[model samples]
Target chain A: MSGTPNQGPGLRYPSNKKSIYDRNLNRTKNAELSRAAFAYLFIEMIAYAQRGVSNVGDLEQKLNTQGYPIGLRLLDLLLSRSSNPLASIRPTRILPLLQFIAQTLYRHLFGRPADALEKSSTEPGQYMLFDNEPMVSQYVSLPRELSSLNCAAFVAGVIEGVCDGAGFPTEGVTAHSVGEQEQGKDAKAMWPDKTVFLIKFKPEVLEREEILGRGGG
Target chain B: MVVFALMIISKSGGLIYNREFHTGLSKLTSNDYLILAGSFHGMHAITSQLSPAPRIPYITPQNNMLAPSPFPNRPTGIEVMESSHFRLQCFQTQTGTKFLLVTEPQQPNVDTMMKKVYELYADYVMKNPFYTVEMPIRCEKFDRGLDGFIKVRG
Candidate 1:
């Protein structure tokens, strides 16, 4: 510190003498984190969230909360990364936003677009984003007591965050193990961890969409 | 061609980030900045509504077939406000967060500069876990990134 005159009085520099500010955001664009390392960290995160939880639903909610900010952060980061700054455009409508999440956000996080995206026929404002195999919960095996809990609630939280960050406020986003219901016994046996994220937008969002669609804006 | 200042407004019309790079313009109190952001947000909304409707919808040639353009005709509000002294260029994200850049009247490529600013905001400010949504920005990395970018480009 004494040898460097430009150094701040109380600031400490790492051996590399580079701060997060000095690093390029795109440096990790094509980089892949080790799956084992990620799994370890994720296990720790789940363990932390599990403490003092009374029920499985509460535990899932806690996990969801933990992933919410991540979704918010990724919303802008991925948007900036996806397009040329000169000709960049963000999704303003419902379908485009869902497509962005189903395609861009999925690929960025899981190395591929989601398996399917479907608007719920029974509900006007509800949509379903499907992942044939959720990477986060692949290694997670819930005991018989907690079989009702789907660890993919964290991913659902992330989806909720993305929707909320994009200005399409959702009523809530929840994850369910839909493999059993949607598939035959053979299919379910093949991919037991298949999950679906149900995204229900707020009524105001649908109203705005209706107006915008009518106005062609 | 000199850059002057930058202001960021949240979707709810709050001045979330404000910084001055050059010293040419008159200084205003922090309260004035809040008012500026709020009024600017309102003005932007009004300008979009005030825009004249396009007489014909945009069409595109797709697979050798003429089809209506997929892009929505959302009216972008006040994009550039120019005056004798400085030019105020605004870039509004789809989420309605506005980035305002004040530059010298003759400055070129202000849009590119604004984009860089947005990128910095996305990386340093948004990614920082401490940052609350729609709150005033106080990220050290963001400040450093902005300063470095302006020093290089300006």
Candidate 2:
């Protein structure tokens, strides 16, 4: 149905009479927002998430929740954009999906692929995605009271969303600053902002992967 | 190319967001917007089901081989509706979120506009930590981004 002649209450038109629906999505595809603007927005996000939080863990969890939906949304958006429509395909296995995240997703968001992707030597379903200098936390300097907090948990949430959205469900994804935990001082100094995203898929996902691997081969 | 309005419906047929840009159409109350979205979702489902089944390609004895189809699964819903005054274009994401754009009947590149709206939704609404899934969007950044893009470019 069309609208009445009178303007609806609460309907605020832009000064130029244009709305968001009129914008083109591809206009910003190659354009980059200013780093300062991004930093300011990120700082505001962290501040908003930090309010009324008693513990660093809770604060990080809030940030993670914030990033989770983003990851989910990005999964579909990136998948559609990366492949040609005629031969479009999505990652069904673990390795290819992880590669998609470490490469395509990373490059899309950060302008660089992740530093490394490593499976845990001891854990069955755990994989580590490393970013040498997480852009999200590049300017974040935690005070002593919240020294344990890592803002990159937001990014970790994104990884978890990608994994979960791709149908490879994960138990949880967490971000940890590994720079301070490095064994050698030289290593620590080299990448002080190194953050590792630990992705642990659910047991059922791994079990399905094993079954598919055996049968498909 | 005037855009009359935009409506975002969640996967389950709930109206999550609705905004009007131009005054070309009759004004509907908020409740009316919900009804319009729900009815449209239902109509879309019916229309999709009404689509004819894929034809069975006959294989001649001399040409028995059928190469796999290159195209992905086709969208099975009503994508565009046109009236004398306005046109409605729907863009449905893989996750089933629907972006509906009401534009002038002769408007060009409505699909592109829908995609851009979807992107804005992804960035400003979905990425905002405070926004709950399937909820009404009240993100300020999305509004500003939408205004800036549409006012200047649309």
Candidate 1: misplaced stretches above 4 Å? A1-24, B1-154
Which window of 10 residues has the lowest lDDT sum in candidate 1 chain A?
Answer: A81-90
Model 2, C-alpha of B37: deviation from truth (Å): 64
Q: Can you give the TM-score per candidate against the true fold?
A: 0.54, 0.52
lDDT of 2: 0.82
List DockQ for all candidates. 0.01, 0.01
On lDDT, the leading prediction is 1
Q: For residues B1-154, what per-residue lDDT tens digits would candidate 2 score against the true structure?
A: 6888889999899999888887656779999999999999999888877887666666686556666466535446899999998899998887778889988899988877878888778766765545567887776557766887788756
Count clashes in each candidate, considering only residues at least 3 apart in sequence or on different chains: 0, 8
